[model samples]
Target: MSLAAQDAAKIPEEIEWTWEVRPAHADAKLPNVLLLGDSITRNYFPEVTQDLTGVANVYLMASSTCVGDPRIEHQIAEFATMEGVRFQVVHFNNGMHGWGYSEAQYKAAFPAFMRTVRALTLESSTLIWASTTPVRIDKEVGPTNARVDERNKIALALITSAKISLDDQHALMMEHRDLYKDDIHFNDAGSKIQGDQAAAQIRAALSMNRLPKAQAR
Candidate 1:
């Protein structure tokens, strides 16, 4: 009935993930945006919402499982229908989990998941696919850097073919390995930087999609 109750009902009992909705200011008239990913997204989400203040309503849907996980599609569908709001942009990533799944298996499931995401959002909504951030070799216990790279390559090919915008978070973090606190998570400063990048990309995508009709003519 309530938003929380609805979220609870949507989440699978066996799934392990965190779902948080950051409502826009009640009086603030702005576009809605959704950010989907794992803990890396959780780390930077606050900064993203803050950075986009007065610009858009930012929502976050994060999971501990891989993007290929079937349960994630259910969570995403719920997020899209929350309060009957349609997001203007959906920025998403998921490659940190699913270590048990081989690269080929990951590749096979990715397109289907993207299809679900596309179906749930507005036809005009900008779908941005963020590559998984790099993991520190010394600290990562599940996915190694080599594995991350392999998965990312597959993701890139699929995302490009789907005609989705690529955010390339992997490249953003590659040069700042020191900013990472562990294999996959970033420190506060790192998160801030990531949030800034994500905000900029979302803003750009929104602007591009909202171009003046007269200007086009």
Candidate 2:
């Protein structure tokens, strides 16, 4: 098996949990965020939450499933049922799921994915769509990083016309190529960098600047 597949199989089937920055935080009401993405975002959530302290209430869920699966819909539905968790930012990534799908499949499901996202929250919640990060195709990663790039463009187009803000994670990954441990995944340091970038994007979209040190927890 490829390294990606091997690594994926080792991940527990149940939702892998992480240390959440508690809601008792001083800035708890700033905004609530839900991170939805594949392994890359999954691996990077800790770093994301760290930089986001005092800026938002962040919850993360990682799935290795592709964008075409029914599980994507199911996952969103489960999150929607979280009582009293008011989400102000729903940051998500999914082109990795679209990577190997046929052209027809991607075209059909892309809109459905957006609809699902829109249906998940209040009409005013800011939606940030991350472009698929670059991969080194020559390595044992997935098929082609180029495919990821293509799908990112599709995602950008969809979000732009829909008027949702887009976080260019592809650009972030390229800016720090050394962060990646392999073609498609980041080591801990890289993951932290990615998380920091994501925090910045969400901050910008919501106009929530980083708070003073004395005020942050």
Candidate whose TM-score is highest: 1
**Predicted structure with the largest lDDT when compared to the true one:** 1
After aligning candidate 1 to the native by TM-score, how far in Å is the CA of 133 from where it should be?
A: 1.0
Candidate 1: which stretches are off by over 4 Å? 1-15, 24-28, 138-141, 213-217
For each of the candidates, the C-alpha root-mean-square deviation to the true structure, in angstroms, is 6.8, 8.0
Pairs that collide in candidate 2 are: 66-97, 67-97
Q: Weakest 10 consecutive residues, lDDT, candidate 1?
A: 4-13
In order, the Cα lDDT scores of the candidates are 0.79, 0.68
lDDT of 1 by residue, 119-217 (tens): 757767899988888887733436788888898899999989888899888999998899979767999999999999999999998787688757522
User: Candidate 2 on 88-112: residue-level lDDT in tens?
Assistant: 7888888664334544455456777
User: What lDDT score goes with residue 125 in model 1?
Assistant: 83
Give candidate 2 regions above 4 Å deviation: 1-28, 82-84, 98-100, 139-141, 208-217
